[model samples]
Target: MTRGTTNPNRLRRVDRWMAWALGDLLRRSESAPVVVDLGYGASPVTVLELAGRLRAVREDVRLVGVEIDPERVARGEAVADPPRVEFALGGFEVPVPDGARPSVVRAFNVLRQYAEEDTPGAWARVVGRLAAGGVLVDGTCDEIGRLATWVDVWAAGSGTSRAGVGPGRGGVGPANAPVPHSLTLSWRLAGLETPSVIAERLPKVLIHRNVPGEGVHALMNALDRAWAVQAPLASYGARQRFVATARSLRDEGWPVLHGPARWRLGEISVAWEAVAPR
Candidate 1:
């Protein structure tokens, strides 16, 4: 059995990130989106809590808690809400009844124990099950869900155009247009020692690639240096120091995502290229 260590409100950070990043998608969907809380551990509290938060955005959101262990699934069923939220027995295959495909799958802290080589197969299994224009959030976080990182996967052959499209293609033609793909790396920065320390808990895909020559390694090193340069701001507090450090990195072309709003929360996100394996 997998370690089922979990706590109430432990996944708040990741949940909040989801709301901010995917809220538009949730609100725009014509039909209610089905969400899978994959591998929700021992208790169903996290699934229950996630349903509450997601429903705040979309009143019609449906949630399903899946566990590989049948006993765990039974336990989840015992605690789950009847229709809006349910429980099932399954692994990465993400078995769904009525031949339904989920719009979103939040698989947090599920693949940390697997061999690195097995990650792609596992990711493919879940991503393949997502509906068109759907998303698969594959991630790992601390037991309490304070620090988290996830990759948002989209189905192939989905919408290529972004929200806003300007007339007259200046930079590149349709064929040369860069594919719309991204990986978001989020960190809770309370006294973060080195970005590489996160390697210990990385979702199986990138854990072993945190070596010296990898893209993740370079990004972490850059973060460490930026943090060191902002040591003077530490007198204000770690939060302020983190914000300043992030701004510095951004000015230096680090692909930092947002401004003080996200920074104040001790979080930073960069494009997948920032940490993709070399």
Candidate 2:
């Protein structure tokens, strides 16, 4: 059984990120986009909440909450409304009906309990069920959905390639560079001692690799040093210090991805390579 910890708006951070990053795809799809909230724990709140948020961008957004545990699935089913959202029993395979493929599959915090070696196959299984232009968002976050990081997976023929690649065979660019789509660090600004503290809650894939010599280790070390150096800026507030610290890191060539929009929220993302395990 998966950890059943979940809350009403606990996944807001990831939900917001998805709306922004995948809005275009939803808008361009021929029909209501199908989205699966794989392994939504304990409650159906997150799945329901996701449907509400995504519907703001595309009124036709459909959501299905899948849980491997029959009891959890039954619980979700009791609350899931028709058309807008539903629940079922399934695992990483993402069993959809009628040969249907989802436009988006969000598996958040679901893989954190699995062995590290299982991630690649798990990713492949879910990604294989994505529609031609669909996406698979694999991520992990805290109970309140803060301090999140997710990788956006595109289908093989989805017209998008990994980041840094040149135009494809037809000279068309990838839908969106397949970089670790986004990494959001949501910390309590006033008490944040070091960025490395987040390692404790990282997805299973990188949690064990937070030791010395790992890329994530190096990145966090640089962040801590940068934060310390920017101590003077804290006089303004932790937010200012964080922004300044982030800017300094960017100046140092860290590939910090988002701007003030994300930083103001106590979040920042860099290329996956910046923090991938060495």
What are the per-model numbers of colliding residue pairs?
0, 0
lDDT of each: 0.73, 0.75
**Candidate 2 pairs with clashing backbones:** none
Model 2, position 96: C-alpha lDDT score: 65
For lDDT, the strongest prediction is: 2
Please write out the lDDT profile of model 2 over residues 198-265, one tens digit for every residue: 77777676778778888777777888999999999887988999998789889999978768777767
lDDT of 1 by residue, 1-278 (tens): 46887788888877887777666666767777788899988888888998999988898888899898887888888877756889988888897756578877898888778887777677667877876556677778877765677766555544422321111233222322222244445566766765556656665677778788887667677878888899888889888888898898899998777578888887777766677666
Q: What TM-score against the true fold does each predicted structure earn?
A: 0.87, 0.88
Clashing pairs in 1: none
Give the clash count for model 1.
Answer: 0
